[model samples]
Each structure stands twice: as C-alpha cells, then as structure tokens.
Target: MKLYKTFTSIIAFLLLTSCSVFEKNRSEQNELAYMKNIEDVAIEVSKKQYVNLLQPGDRLIILVSAQDQDVVKVFNQNYSATEQFRESSVPRGNIISNSQPINGPTYIIDGDGFIDFPVLGKIEAAGMSLDHLKQYITSSLKRYIKEPYVQARITNYRITVLGEVRNPGQFTIADGTATVLNAIGMAGDLTIYGKRDDILIVRNVNGLISKERIDLTDAGFIDSPYYFLKQGDIIYVTPNKTQERLAKRDPNSALYISIASIVVTIIALIVRK
Candidate 1:
C-alpha cells in the first residue's frame, strides 16, 4: 500500500511539473542577476544600437516637404500638375500615392542599389542608413527647392518569430522601434515548455547569416549588441525536454498506457474483493 501511494504521488508530481521548464533552474532564470552585487556606483552597459542600413530590393517611403509646394510637386504624382509624372514613376515600380502632394510613391532600390529621383537622376542608396540617406536627399534638394525637408523610412521593417511561443508569426517593426523582448511580447511571450534561458536569434549580418542564442531571463541581454532585433531577424524559441518527451509520445502509446492503467485498476479491485 505504501509503495502504491508513493508511485501515485510521483505520477501526480510529474504531471504537475510537466512543462514547467523555468522552475527547474530558478537561479539561472533570473533576468538581472548581475545587479545583485552592485552597490551605488553608476555603471552603463552597452545596449543594442539599432541602425537601419539600406539594401538592394528594399522599398523606401520618401516624402519631401518644402516652403513652395510647386517645387516639391515634381517628385510626386502632381509634380507635373498632371498624370504624366505618375505615369513616369509606374515603369520604375513605385507604389504611388498621389492624392497628398507631400507623400511620394514608395521607391524600390534597384539590384545595383540605385534609386531614381526627380531631377536628381539615379542615386546610390544602398549601404546608407536611413538618417544618412535622408540627410543626403535633403542636402541635394536644397540645390533646387529652398529649405527642403525630407523624411525617408523603410516601407518594410519586419521580422519573424517561431517555435514554443503562444503566438508565432511575422511582425513589422514600425520605425525600427521594437526590441527582442518586444517581439516576444508580441508573440504573447514564451510557452511554459519554452527554454527561456536559451532563445535563438537568426539574422543576416552583412553578407553572412548569423545565429545566436539569447537568454530572456538574463538582464545582461540588454547589454548585448544583438539585443535590438534587426529587419528579417528570425526568433526561434526551442522547447524544453519535457515538451520533447511529450511530443515523442505517440497516440497509440498513450492509448495503450490508458488501457494498461485501467486493467491494473480492475485487477487491483478484483484482488481486494
């Protein structure tokens, strides 16, 4: 009877702690363990500095504002005060929005990393940050339009999240304002079976692809250079061992286990009787 009771308790405990991966290692699961020894001395950790660099096949939403709307109009659908300018931009593969004079069509960078601008001709834009590109455009437009104000941003700043998350999908990082935690938050955080101590981040750095494991439970992740999720980053959260074991169990095996448990219960009852 004591042996049976012990067996039952073990099963109950296993069932209760099935997918609780974070509970297994409480000390390593801390998000900010490095802060424990800090006294009053101010310290600064190097956080992820997100800088968006333009690349080929990237689409940019470019809008130029000026004191004289007519000078800037040539860059938009109404630039020519007619459909001629709009027709010219269509062959260039720009997403046109002409109703508003200030907003220009979305420009796609060519394979050679060049974009065609009104009066400016083809300009090399790839490898330039959004701010640098904006400054370049503003400086160039100053030659024609007086005090030209340029606003440039990437049309597609997106990343993908997958595996062991409550919600896994592709999400856009509007204005490059999202972080690693923010992306996880968008995915409704990690599942109970997720290994929070080792989350994977896959990205294309320069010409090469890089894969890194980041811990969500560590505050030191804030100091990592890759903390800020870049465009096209893939965040993959691997499941803990408990989930793996659960996944490895087949339906047939589960059915057989249930049948065996029932048979054992029946035999024990018969023996008691």
Candidate 2:
C-alpha cells in the first residue's frame, strides 16, 4: 500500500508538470485587452490616412494612351495584346508570365529623384503621388499627342512578414492600399504559438528607419500610427514563451524529467524497504 501511494504521488506530480505542455499557449493575452471595459462596444478608427508616394528604388508602371494610334504605337507596351506599340503598358512587380511574356521598357528613377522620360528629359518623380504623376505626365504629353491621358501605378509596392507566421515572405500590394491585417492574412495568419499581442512593424520613413510594436488583441492598437502599412514595411510576429522554449535547444527539460524520475525511484525504494 505504501509503494502504491508513492507511485501515485509520482504520477500525480508528473501529470501536474506535463499539463503545461498541452496547455493552449497561443493568443495568451487576447482576453486581457487594455481598452476592455464593461461598457465597451465600438471604437472609432483614428489612423492618419495617406496615399503612398514615389520613392527611390521604387518601380512604376507608366502608360500613356490617346486617340491617336501612332502615339500609342510609340509609347504603348506589349503587356496587353495588339502589337502596334513600342513598349509595354504596365509592369508587373514580380509577376513573370512566360506564356504571354510580361516585358517592358522602364524609366528607372535616378539617385537625384529623376527619370529620363521620353521628350521630358529628367522629370522629378520621386516624391510625386500616383495621381499627381499621372497629371504631370498628361500635361507634358499634351505637346506631343492630343487628348493625352496617363495611367501610372507603383509596381514594386511590397511588404514582408516574418517570424511565427504560417508563411513568411515578401508580398506585393497590387493597389497600394494594404493594411496590417492584410499583411498578416497574406502570411497565412500567425501560427498557433504566435504571440498576437506583440507584433513588430519595421518601416522606412523618408530616409530614417523605424520599428513599431503593435498589439492585435488591443482595440486601441487599431487606430495606431502603425496600423496602415507603407511601402517596404516588414512585419514580425513574436512567439510566445511556450514557443520560445520549444524553439530553444536547451537540455534542461530532459534534465528536469530525469530528476523527477530519479526522485520517484528513490521514493519507491524507500517505500519498498
């Protein structure tokens, strides 16, 4: 009976310690929202809204169209069908279609924030918005072609999400309106052991690089400055303590288990004696 009691105690202790291993460690802080209240219902979104602006090393798809087929022939690209054009219409960021072959002649922005556009020579396009650049191109093209209309978009608008996500890599924003949630979604959402409360977003502001921590579980973080993702933003979702321990190659866990077994064996021997 004494040996039976000793074995039962050892089993109970093992159960207690092993229970933490099976515990759901994901979304640990989801229930503890700092903004939570008994009367909490809805909150207003207060993120400062702004359009993405052109920057150095950014790729743009500049397309010029008019009623005149001759003008289209000189400027239009073969991105679409109808091969009466000199260059492609719009550039696909990282999309390569060997079937149709997405190829184009691009105007790379120089170090001084200028692109050597046809007829315009060096035009300042680094800081111009998409709409503003379209307007600027349209006005300049009026001298060469009547009824000049321009279509411009940033093709290299991409963000990266890494660490503790289902899928971590670079993703392109087709419309340039990607949000933090969108980036997380593209990464196949965070892993089961991911720390939802502490997410890091690294961004480049003008010439300065910055890092911001955001908590998805908190309602107030929705209206934060880092809510909206900008071009070249990199998001990193931190792992919880359980995940950290699992990732670590420490032998301390086996050591503890071995110690517990040794203690159990000593108790069994004492009880048998």
Taken over the whole model, the C-alpha lDDT of each candidate is: 0.66, 0.68
Q: 42, model 1: CA deviation in Å?
A: 12
Q: List, residue by residue over 47-158, the lDDT tens digit for candidate 1.
A: 2356767878777777788888887878653222221122111111112223233335577789899999878889899888878888998898888889998876565667
Q: Give the true-structure RMSD of model 1.
A: 8.7
Q: Count the backbone clashes (under 3 Å) in each candidate.
A: 4, 2
Q: Write the per-residue lDDT of candidate 2 for residues 118-223, one digit (tens) a residue.
A: 7667789888876788798888888889898776655677788899888788876645656787677777888766777789999997779999998776676767
TM-score of each: 0.63, 0.67
What lDDT score goes with residue 124 in model 1?
Answer: 93
Best by TM-score: 2
Backbone clash tally (model 1): 4
Candidate 2: global Cα-lDDT?
A: 0.68
Model 2 residue runs over 4 Å out of place are 1-20, 24-48, 76-104, 205-207, 249-273
